[model samples]
Target: MHILKKGLVILFGSILLSIGINFFLVPFELLDGGIIGVGLIIKYLTGMKPGLAIIFLSIPIFALAWFYNKSYFYNSLFGMLFSSFVIDLLSFSRGYIQLQIPPVVSSVFGGIFVGLGIGIMLRYETSTGGTDLLAQFLSKIFKINVGIMIFIIDALVICLGGLLISKESFFLSSLTITVVALFTSLCTWNDERTKLKTS
Candidate 1:
């Protein structure tokens, strides 16, 4: 029953992520951070599918997880694969998901949806891997806060993406990541509260 519940959560999360990417970000060439940002950069440059690029890019990170953190490897592998597949499967929706809202509105909503998806999965102790997984590993080794590492990585990705894509993308992506961080924090706040009470 627990495994089934986790599977369902992962599926739901993946759907939300795909919707955000296809419906909101793609329209304006906006970006999110982490591996997703890298994937988008590749997609924008080579016209390749972001999902495919994500999978290819994650191979080395996943390999490291397999060797050093088998538990993380198991937890994130399915989530990553499923999410990547869903993102690619929904890629066609970009053409049909036209919204009349401003680009800022789109970026905000996109961040919300993406953050909700990621946060929900994280609450269940699962994730779509990529840099999130890498951040965890590095945090363990360096005794740094995982959140800080993730922020640094995300910031770098956004900056790189902005430089390569456009100035507008850089600014909008900055807003998007901020919103994503807010919603993700909200979603996971209960866990932190529980830990605080216990500790």
Candidate 2:
């Protein structure tokens, strides 16, 4: 029952995350950090599918996971696969999703949706993998907030994306990541507090 609930949460979260990417960010050429950012970069440069790009980029990391520990890989695989599929499906069928918000507004709202999506998945002990998994590990090791760690990693990816994209992307994407970090932190804090009380 718990597993089923978790799976549903991840599924719901993935839908919102994909919407944030396709409906809000993609039209603006804005990027989110991590594998999603990499996928967008690939999409911009090669016109390939971002979902496929994400899966391909994740392969090496997932393959490497098998040599050390399989638990993390198993935990992440479902969330990653489902999210990637949803992203591609939405991107392909994006004719239905139209929002003409300004770039900054899109970034802010997109970040909130994406952050909440990711936060819920992470709270459930699953994630879309790549930097998210790395952020989780680093958070445990460094005893820092997972959201802050994710923000640091995302900053690097966005900077790289800016070099490949544009100056406008560099600045606005920073705002996007900051809000992502802020909202993710808030969610994580709330989830942890709830857990502490329940436990």
Candidate 3:
């Protein structure tokens, strides 16, 4: 029962994230960081499917997770898979999701939705793989916070994306991803505090 609930949470969360990416971000040529960011770069540069690129790029990160943290591997495996699938499924709607809102609105709201999805997955002890796995590993070894590591990694990716995309989109995408990371950190903080208090 618990597994079923977790699966559903991940599934729904991934779907929302997919919608945010395909419906909002991709339409505007906006990018986020991590594997998804790279996938967007590939899609823009090579005309390949972003979802396919995401799955391929995430393999190494997932393998790292599998070797280092068994629990993380088990939890995140399905979340990554489901997210990849959902992203691909939503790809058909690319550039077609009309909204009355402005580009900035899309960036803010899209980041929020993506962050919420990621946070829910984390709440269940699962993940969406990609640089998130790398961030966790780095945090443990370097005595940095995972959220900070994630922000740095994502920032780097956004910079690279800026080179590939327009400056305005790059800045907006960076802003969006900043909010996404912030929201994720906020969501996970209470859990960490609770654990610390209990311990």
Clash totals for all models, in order?
Answer: 0, 0, 0
Candidate closer to the true structure by lDDT (higher is better), 2 or 3 = 2
Error of 2 at 102 (Å): 0.8
Query: Residue by residue across 81-146, what tens digits does model 1's lDDT show?
Result: 999999999997667767888999999999988888887887787889998788767755775544
Provide the global lDDT of candidate 2 against the true structure.
0.87
Clashing pairs in 2: none
What TM value does model 3 have? 0.92
Report the C-alpha lDDT of model 2 over 129-162, residue by residue, as the tens digit: 8788778878867867899999999999999999
lDDT of 3 by residue, 1-199 (tens): 9999998989878987887788778778888888988998999889898878988999888887778888878888788888988988888766465777788888888888787777777767777888876776786688565666778899999999998788988889988898788887877778766765786
Question: Model 2: how far is 122 from its true place, Å?
Answer: 0.3
lDDT of candidates 1 onward, in order: 0.85, 0.87, 0.82
- lDDT of model 3 at residue 14? 95
Residue 142, model 2, lDDT: 82
Residue pairs that clash (backbone atoms under 3 angstroms), model 1: none
* Model 2 lowest lDDT segment of ten: 190-199
Q: In model 1, which regions exceed 4 Å deviation?
A: 138-149, 196-199
In candidate 2, stretches whose alpha carbon ends up further than 4 angstroms from where it belongs are: 192-199
